[model samples]
Target: MEFWKNCWNCGHDTPQERVALEFFPRIVEMFSKKEDGKVNQRVWAVFYDSYSFTKCKKCSAPSLFVDEYWTQTTSPEEAKCIAEEVKINGVSKSGNLVHSHIYPGFLKEPFPQWTHDLEETYMVLFWEVYQAAALGLNSLAMMGIRAIIDKFALDKIGDIGGFAKKLNTLLNAKIINADQHALLEVVVDAGNASAHRGYKPDNNHVKICLQIIEQLIGIEKFGDVINEIRQATPKRT
Candidate 1:
C-alpha cells in the first residue's frame, strides 16, 4: 500500500510505500451509540483501527502508523468507491483520519530548521511546542509558547520580575520593537489564558499565536546574522 505524507526525516510531503505485508486490521471496538441508548445493543455502526509499516520513498526512512477509520460514516456508494479504490490502487481513499501515529513522528509542516543552531533547550522545546500546535493541542501549545518566551527572557536578561517588565526591557534594549512587543504581549496573554484559565483556543486563534512565536524565534535566532550582513554591505557615501 502506498500513500502520501509529510516525511519527518525528509521534511517534505512524499509518497510512502508500505511493505506488502504491512497493513492489518488490528482492532475493532463497538464504536457507535445505539438508538435505544442501551449498553449492549448492536447497530450498523462500526469502525476500524489499522496499522501500517511504511518506508518513505524520498528519504528511505521507516515509519509505523496507526490510522483510525470510521467506515460506517460514509454512504454505501462511497463505501463501494472505497472498496474499488482499495482494489485498484491498493489504498483506502475514504474515511476521516481521526488520528495519525507516525513513528519517528512528523511535523504537519516545515518549521524553522535554523532554530536547531540556537540553544539546545529552546531548540528542542520550540519543536515540541510546534508539534503540539500541529496536533491541535492548543492549550498545551499556548503554555509552551509562554514558557519559551520566559526562558528566552531569562537567558537574555535574568529573572527580571514579571512578564511586563521583561517585555519592556526587551523593547527598551531594541531586542524587540513596540509593534513586536505588542504582538508578544498577545502571545503571552494567550498562553496565560490557556495555562491558568483552561482556555482552549480555536484553530485559527492558535495559528496566529504560533505565527507570532515563529517570527519571534526567527528574530531571536537570525537577528545577529542579519546584522552582520548589513554591516558588510558597502556604504552609499
Candidate 2:
C-alpha cells in the first residue's frame, strides 16, 4: 500500500510504499479437551506476525511495516483475519503491551491561539514555557513562566523593575484587582524560586502557573471585546 507520513529519520513529509515478504512458521505448542458430550477446541489458528519493509519514496529510508493475522473461529475451515498495520504488540500475561513510535513533532495538545496576539518576546517566552512543560522540564518551564511575567509587564507598563514591583504597578494601574494580584504574587514567588534557587516545581504547580497566565492574557487581550459582544447579544425571551 502507498501512504504519506512524516519521516522521523529524514525529517521530511514523504510518500511510502510497502514491500511484501515470504512467510515462515514458528512452532507453538497447542492442546485440546472435551467436556460432557461436546467437543471443545483449545487451540486457535496460528497468527503470522511478520515485518515488511516500506521505503520512503522521497528519502529512500526503510521503515518496518507490521502484518498480523489470526483466526476468527475455532474451525480450521474458517477464513483467517488480517490486520495490515498493527501498531500495538501482543498483550502480555500481565496485561502489559508495547505501543508504536509516536511522532514528537505533532503535539497531542495544542497551545492557545491568544498567544500570537502577545508581543514577540512575550509570545516566545510563553511558548518556551509550554514546550518545557510538555517535555517534563519543570524547572525550565517555571523559569520561562517567570520571564513571561517580566516581559508582559515591560510591554504593558513600559517599565523595568523587579517582578513584585511590576505586579504592584499593574495593581495600581487597575490592570489587575486585589484578588488577581494575590494569585499572581503566588505564581511570581514560585517562578522566582525556580529561577534563582534551583527549585523544580511539580506538574500541579506548573499547571496552576500556566492556567493563571493563560487566564490573565485572555482577559488582558479580550476583556473589552467580550463586554462588547455580551452587550450586543440579545437576551432570551
Candidate 3:
C-alpha cells in the first residue's frame, strides 16, 4: 500500500512505500485494587502495534515510524478475536492509526523560502504567527495577521488613519487592485472579528487568510507589482 506523507528531507509531500513492516495485536490488562488491598483485573484493551519502515519516493529518505491501531477496551473473547484477526491479516489500511517518527525525531510544517524576504519585524512576526496557527492557536494567529496588516500599511503609507482608511489609501494609491483590495478587506475584517468579536476561524479559514497574505507579500503583490509600480510612476504627458 502507498501513503502520502511529508518528506522530512525534501520538505515536500510525497508518496511513501512501506519497505519493512511487522505488526501484531497485543492486549493490555487493566487492574483495579479492592479495599482489601487485593488487585483484580478490571478490563482489557487490544491494539495492533507495529513498526513501519517507509521511504519517501521523491527524496528516497527513509523514516522509521512506530504505529498503534484499534486501541479500545474489549472483553477477553473480543480481544482474542481481534488478536487473531490482526495476527492473521496484518495491518488494515482502513483504520485509525497513530504514526510517530522514532528515527529522525519530529518535523514541523515548512514555510516558503520567500517569506524571509519580508521586512525584519513583519518577517519575524509572520513566522511566529505561522507557528501559532500550526499549534492551533487560531484566535492569536488571526490577531497576529491583523497586526501585520496594520504594520504593513503603516510602513507603506504612514499612519494612514484606521484599518479601513489604510485599505482605502492603498486602493487610491493603486498599491492593490479592486480584487486584491476586496480580499484584503475580507481577511482584515475577519481578523477584527477574531480579535474583538470572539470569532474563532477554522483551519481552512486561516489557511485562506495566510494564502492571501502570502500573495500580497510576493513580487506579484496579489496581482501585478510591476503594474502597480508603473501606476505609481508619473506618466510622460
Candidate 4:
C-alpha cells in the first residue's frame, strides 16, 4: 500500500511520510505573440529527488524532510514579453516560476554561517584593491625611469640612491624641465616608499599615483590601464 525508502547518506529506513521531493528545471521557455507582442515565460521542469529518514545510524539524529514539486509551461509569445519586462524592470512581477522546497528551518540552520563567510570574502577583496594600487604604481615608476634612461642619454642608476642622483643631475642640467623632473622625483619617492617601507597610504597617495601614471602615459589610456591592473589583483574577501 505504501512505499518505503532509506536515507542515501545515513542508510536509515525512511517512512513514506518522511520522504521529501525537490524539482528544478533545465530550461525556461520565453515567448511573445504574433498578434500583440505580449510576453510570458514558464519553467521547464527537471526532476531531482531527495529524502529524509526517521533516524540516522551513526548519530541517531531524527530525519528531517525536504522536497519540492511543480509543473508548468509557457507559450512562445508570452515568454518573449516576460523577457522584455525583465530587461526593462530588472525583476519579474511574479517571482521566477521555478520553485524550491527545503527542510523546515533550512535558512535558520545554514544561512548565518554562510553569511559570515561571505562577508569575510568581501573584505579580503576590498583590501586587495588597495594593495594592487600600490604595487601598480611602483611598477609604473620603474618602467618610466628605464624608458627615460634609454631615450635620453641619462645614466643608468644602480639603486634607489643612485637613481635619484642621476635623475636630479638630468633636472639640474636642464635636459628635462622643472615640472617633468619634479614629477619624476615624486613618482620615484612614492614608489620607493610603497615598495620598500610599509607606508600606510592615504587618499592623497592614490590620487598622486593616478596622476603620475596619466602623465607618463596618456590620461585616457592610462586610466583604463590602471583600472585593469587594479581589477586583475585578487580581492581580499
lDDT of 1 by residue, 173-218 (tens): 8888899899999999989999888799888888787788778877
**RMSD versus native structure for model 3:** 8.8
Query: Weakest 10 consecutive residues, lDDT, candidate 1?
Result: 20-29
Sort every candidate by lDDT, greatest first: 3, 1, 2, 4
Q: What total of clashing residue pairs does each candidate reach?
A: 0, 0, 0, 23
Candidate 3 positional error at 68, Å: 5.7
Candidate 2 backbone overlaps, count? 0
In angstroms, give how far residue 172 of model 4 lies from its true place: 3.7
Clashing pairs in 3: none
- lDDT (10s digit) by residue, model 4, range 1-237: 123334434444443342232222244344545545465444345322223333444444454443222223434444444444433432234334343232232222222222233234333332343344434443444433334333333332334345567677767777667887777777666556655664445656655654553344332235566999999999999
In model 4, the worst 10-residue window by lDDT is 105-114
Q: Which pairs clash (backbone N, Cα, C closer than 3 Å) in model 1?
A: none
Higher-scoring candidate on lDDT, 3 or 4: 3
Model 4 gets an lDDT of: 0.43
List candidate 3 stretches off by more than 4 Å.
Answer: 1-6, 10-53, 57-59, 64-70, 74-110, 129-141, 157-162, 169-178, 196-204, 219-237
> What is the C-alpha local distance difference test score of each model?
0.74, 0.67, 0.74, 0.43
Show where candidate 1 strays beyond 4 Å: 1-47, 52-65, 69-97, 108-113, 172-175, 202-204, 220-237
The true-versus-predicted C-alpha distance at residue 105 of model 4, in Å, is: 34
Q: What are the TM-scores, per candidate, against the unseen true structure?
A: 0.59, 0.53, 0.54, 0.27
What does candidate 2's lDDT look like per residue over 111-180, in tens digits? 7788888767777888888888977889899888777777778877977578788999999998888998
Distance (Å) between predicted and true CA of 91, model 4?
20
